[model samples]
Target: MEDIHALIQKLDWDTSEAEQAEAIHKLQDIQDEELRLLLQPLGKEYWDGAAEVIVKLGYPSVKPILPGLLEWIQDMNWPGAGRIAPLLREIGDPLIPYIQDVFRNHSQDEEWMYWIFEMIIDYWDKDQIVQIQEELIRLTEGKIIALKALRTLWVHQIYSGESVLLLLEDKMQRSLTEIAQLEIAYPGIDCEALGRGFSEAIFTPELSRAYIEEHREEFNFCHRKSTLHDFVSEIEELVSECMGSGNAPA
Candidate 1:
């Protein structure tokens, strides 16, 4: 086996372009499994440069790296930990079967399921997205992960992100006398995401109320029990104002 110590060292972010080129060349000479090793980075917290090199190498760099990623993702916090999502996007549709399995297996792990869905989003057509959504919805029925899947449905334009966020609005609510707590009913739930749904203005009140009313008893809602009249009035005002604004973009 060729020694990779120097080559890995040269791939550091601080290295010159020519040095990086040489390191990349040496990386290309390494076997696929070893190439996957190079992704560890020349130094700690150096994912940017390492990810760039991996992503730039295109399909070859990503293929062998994926199985490990499929496992690593289980422990990862997406949109925060690393650039792996972009790298996975470079891997693309060819890894569809693998990702589907990841989502299927980790349906209860909300963040992992979210990122895996994101990595594979662009690859699936609307029809495929719908199929996947229905399957996940069934597997995750009445759980927090079902709300997470709603985010993906919004991304595919099959549902509005706001509408999905609205579905979680009740979870974010609390009466003045009461404190909000994570819904104990659903394990591994992501309450902050539900909070983000409103803080970010990604909510459609009418849509949220319809869902809340439909599943009033079954939803793992963590909010204080507010009066039905109050909820109705809130949705009505939102709908009236929105209609006046020509159904303002959700």
Candidate 2:
């Protein structure tokens, strides 16, 4: 363990790229279950190096250590914590099940779940991400992590906006409140992400028209009243264009 810790120290962020590469090479040379176990505890102390070694080991070789790695990264302040994101992304689809487990077991740990989503969720392939649609929707109820889920859905173009609205109305309501709180927490931060998400999720003429009609009062009540009303107007115009052309609502 002491020897492994020394190797990980050599991979610290302050080390030169060449030096880190050399350390990575040395660690990769001795990959095995024992070495992998020794590397786990060092994740907090030497994550920069430990994560690189795990990334190189790849797939099934590193699969058993994933839950531990997930736990290790809960502390964003840890050394080389940023590297853990890429490592999870490199592990790719194989990491999804473990992430789903985190969602199940740690549903109350919104901060940890939010960090996990921020670090790796957007980086995963769309096919892999869709595996957790239910969990993602559930996460929309989270005070800290809802924005991450909403952004992932918007970016990936998963589900119809109306469907997302119907299935996740209560949760989306909470997510909107969370977004407002986030704007307060970080003044001048871009809150238009919510608007963009709404646009992407509810683009169809029927869905847009129905949503505006049903939720117009809610939009009027929003803190950013003018911005949301403008969004509703855009949707209404799309509805009018479709109707003028004699296209049935879809």
Candidate 3:
């Protein structure tokens, strides 16, 4: 544990690159139960560098870290499932079942569920990603467990290049608008950040118009395109060009 302490003391963004790499390398070598123990609390905002130490330990580290992450979620510990999802993703596809089970068990915690979706984008293969898009669409079409689900689907649809507006109802549209206006720490997630595309996807002209139409007197619809159906058509064309002639995603 002294090694863990010494190595962690060296892990700072301000440190020299060589120092950072050396600390990470040494942390990776620990490769034991103690390393996993460090992962539990380190998964949070401050001690995340320690989490990276376990991440550097890679697949072998997965088995030990995962159970603790899930337990924290199940027990509603601080930071909870939302913080752990991306950390879990660092170990990749092996944790799919654990992630899936969380949705089944704690489906009502919406933001955490969406974080899980974002994590899959970095880890899962293309086919698995397709399945995620479909499942998210299905989830959005039904009674939502968390309002954030629509926003999650909205971003997935941007990449899927699918017509999200057509699949969604008025309520889902409102949910999307709410998230568009929500204060999020963009490029903030661990493993991989949400990126600029997510911001643009949520504020698409079509969704903006829907919000304006719903609350006509609330605000000006400055985002409205010259054609009422303009953004939808652009998205369709984009889908066709990107995916080729076939309606199915390539």
Candidate 4:
């Protein structure tokens, strides 16, 4: 552990790229939290190395660092936002609140907010649908990012197609066509699958159900159903099959 700590201390963010890469690889072998924490300050200059450290530590080891990482999002000077986003992305829903809070507050620096919003729409508590709706309104604000966010929400069913259609009622035809085109162009590669998989692997059904209920509007849209009831029925059948098959939940 001391040797690991020494290696972390010796990590030079300004080092040659080869040296930095070597430090990152060496850091991946250390498992102690105190040692990990000792290396936390390195995140500022060695963002990639920090990310590798976090991933090496995994969730339990990294959990302690979350609050600090969340606080780092607001650090104007830290390039931690971009580096942290991928780590949080790797951590997935277990880190949802931290990600959501960043989006909720409109933390736009580093585009971390956008990344967080994308992750939440993909994997957060379905009950957060209302929050997602609010976020869509707040962050998107009619820009290209918003359009992209909206498309993400639509794909994940974070907002029901009806809700989105209603929101864009003024441009329904155009938006719907755009959404369909975007869906095919991008396919099912958004946060939804990741969220569902995380939910099944780490969360309870009740929690999963809450996520579903919160995002029923979006789910309804995915099924091409006009009503929530139809969507719910389909979800039940899917859930049953998933559980019976011993597949990863999603």
Best by lDDT: 2
The lDDT for every candidate, in the order shown, is 0.54, 0.64, 0.49, 0.54
Candidate 3 clashing pairs?
Answer: none
Clashes of each: 0, 1, 0, 7
Stretches of candidate 1 off by over 4 Å are: 14-17, 41-46, 70-83, 118-124, 139-144, 151-250
lDDT of 1 by residue, 1-250 (tens): 3477666776666789898777666566566657666455545434445555565566755677776666544545422135556666555556667767767665667667665655556455666666566565554344345544554565566655455446445433422222223234344544445545444443777766665565444444433323333444454444444445443323
So what's the TM-score on candidate 1? Answer: 0.52
Backbone clash pairs in model 4 (N, Cα, C under 3 Å; residues 3+ apart or in different chains), count = 7
Candidate 4 C-alpha lDDT tens digits along 146-167 = 5445545654556545454444
Candidate 3 segments exceeding 4 Å error: 12-21, 40-48, 67-92, 121-123, 126-250
Residues 1-250, model 3: lDDT tens digits = 3367667666655667788677777776675656554544432542445556655565655576675554543423344344455556565656666666666666676655655655544445554555455445445544433223444543334333244334433544554454445324222222112223334445688865564465442222222311223434443444444346332333
In order of appearance, the predictions have TM-scores of 0.52, 0.55, 0.45, 0.45
Cα displacement (angstroms), candidate 2, residue 27, comes to 2.0
Best of the two (1, 3) by lDDT:
1
Which prediction has more favorable lDDT, 1 or 4?
Answer: 1
What lDDT is obtained when candidate 1 is compared to the true structure? 0.54
- Candidate 2, residues 175-231: lDDT per residue as tens digits? 456556655665643335545545865868787777667655444445454444443
Largest TM-score belongs to which candidate?
2
